[model samples]
Target: MDTPLKNLAIIGAGAMGSGIAALFASKGLNIVLIDPMEGALERALKTIDRQLNVYAPGGVQEAMQRIQVSPGLEAACNSDLVIEAVPENLELKRGIFAKLDSLCPARTLFATNTSGLSINAIASAVVRRDRFVGTHFFTPADVIPLVEVVRNDDTSEDTVARVMATLRFAGKRPVLVRQDIPGFIANRIQHALAREAISLLEKGVASAEDIDEVVKWSLGIRLALSGPLEQRDMNGIDVHYAIASYLYKDLENRTEPSELLKSKVESGQIGAKNGQGFYTWSPERRERVLREKSAALGELAAWLNGKAGGS
Candidate 1:
């Protein structure tokens, strides 16, 4: 779509922002990495080079000239699309969009890399509400293949379809979400397992390792071949409907933290990002692990493509 998103701007030079910039540039798009912080824009560009070499060596090696580093909001105003990946805070995100709304052309598509924000709220800051969409990329965008293309009530069908096609051309799985709600589809399903896993830990039901092992060995295998909705049909809808009727409440967030999770997170056991969570590993080691996961997932994707009669 749109000739592989020929011009893209990733505003903000944070981790997610740089990752997004790298992904577009690696896909042979003209990319602008924008930020105002001292050295932030430069650092993000360097990080893009470093990350691309790891995520898509062949593509980035060939498309290394596609990226451009810029230090202000004005640099992104001319882009075809601008993806804001600033901090998780709402006011800051709105502020960026407000400025972008004033600066960018009416045709420029504005997207957010937010994980949990409401798409409607984000769109309110932009003038072209019909052109704004939630383009959520997973961590390390250049490597991760699945991108959630979200559309709220204000978004136009053309924008949604264009986003889907652009991402598809970039060689990513674009999951179309009909309705834009909090957490969207994958995250709702993700949090379901997360809450249950934490509950098991709090109740002394099983260690985190054992809990993860069970899911990874079983549900993970089934998911590898088919998604949850497909698995439901394969396993029989009657059984799923019965189970859903019985276990529906288990999916919701009943407790805030149960004190145990609160303590774990508050005490700096905030997972691999901080070298600890339920597991421990050095930051460098963790990146290596994630790279391995990316390679494995990429191979699976490639094989799946071949099976589906794709080159």
Candidate 2:
């Protein structure tokens, strides 16, 4: 079935929300991006314009024409798809969905851009529970291809299909998360790696710089080409099993956040956004890192799209 997602409404003007708006606009869909905070709409418009130039330069004018900025929920009343990209707080999300439920049409699909919140809990606040789902887009939503389309118990198969189809139409790769489990799929795997990485740092197994180098130079590249499961197959199940049997026991199985990480945050060294975390960052250094990262991601995405068989 063709996607029924022409009138899209994104109810936030932050990084993820703006990126999503730019992404939809680039795909020729009319978008209404809403946020009530002063100057937020302006920022979102600028962000959309900037991202469009980077990702869809040839169509920037046309895409910008299709995007409208709003500071009110009423603008989304006629939307076919309403994606809530507000803060990750459950109460905040529930309030927005409740308000949207009253304002939007019954047929409008409601999706949350929550990274790890329970889809079921969020859907409970709205009457159209079956229409509620989660579309967890990664940072730089316009560039990232993977979107987790999460479903709650009340969600219908038709809702899932429509969301997947809509994402595919918008030039995204959507994966269905059948259950509303915590950390759904990618995040669960990500945190597993993070826990171990942080634990390694805490134990002085390696310096933070060296640890990152290992990840970026080694694990990150190979994992992009083939997933862990596929790699296990290639390495022989028996061999992997033998290693995992012993390795898993030695791996970090901490239920709590790493003390080393807690200490960094406690001291206000909260990464590039600030000036320090694992590494110190000057404005120039941060900008360079961001520029280099964006370039690398763009290159990787292009290579994957063109020659990686849509990996």
Candidate 1, poorest ten consecutive residues by summed lDDT: 249-258
Q: Top lDDT: which candidate number?
A: 2
Quote the lDDT for 153 in model 2.
Answer: 91
Model 2: what TM-score? 0.97
Write out the backbone clash pairs for model 2: none
The runs of at least 3 residues in candidate 1 whose Cα sits more than 4 Å from the true structure, single-residue gaps closed, are 242-255, 308-311
C-alpha lDDT score of every prediction, in listed order: 0.81, 0.90
Writing each residue's lDDT as its tens digit, candidate 2 over 200-248 gives 9899999999999999898898887889999889989999889888898
- Give me the overall lDDT of model 2: 0.90
TM-score leader: 2
The sequence of per-residue lDDT tens digits that candidate 1 reaches over residues 6-28 is 78888888888887777777677
Each model's backbone clash number: 0, 0
Candidate 2: stretches off by over 4 Å: none
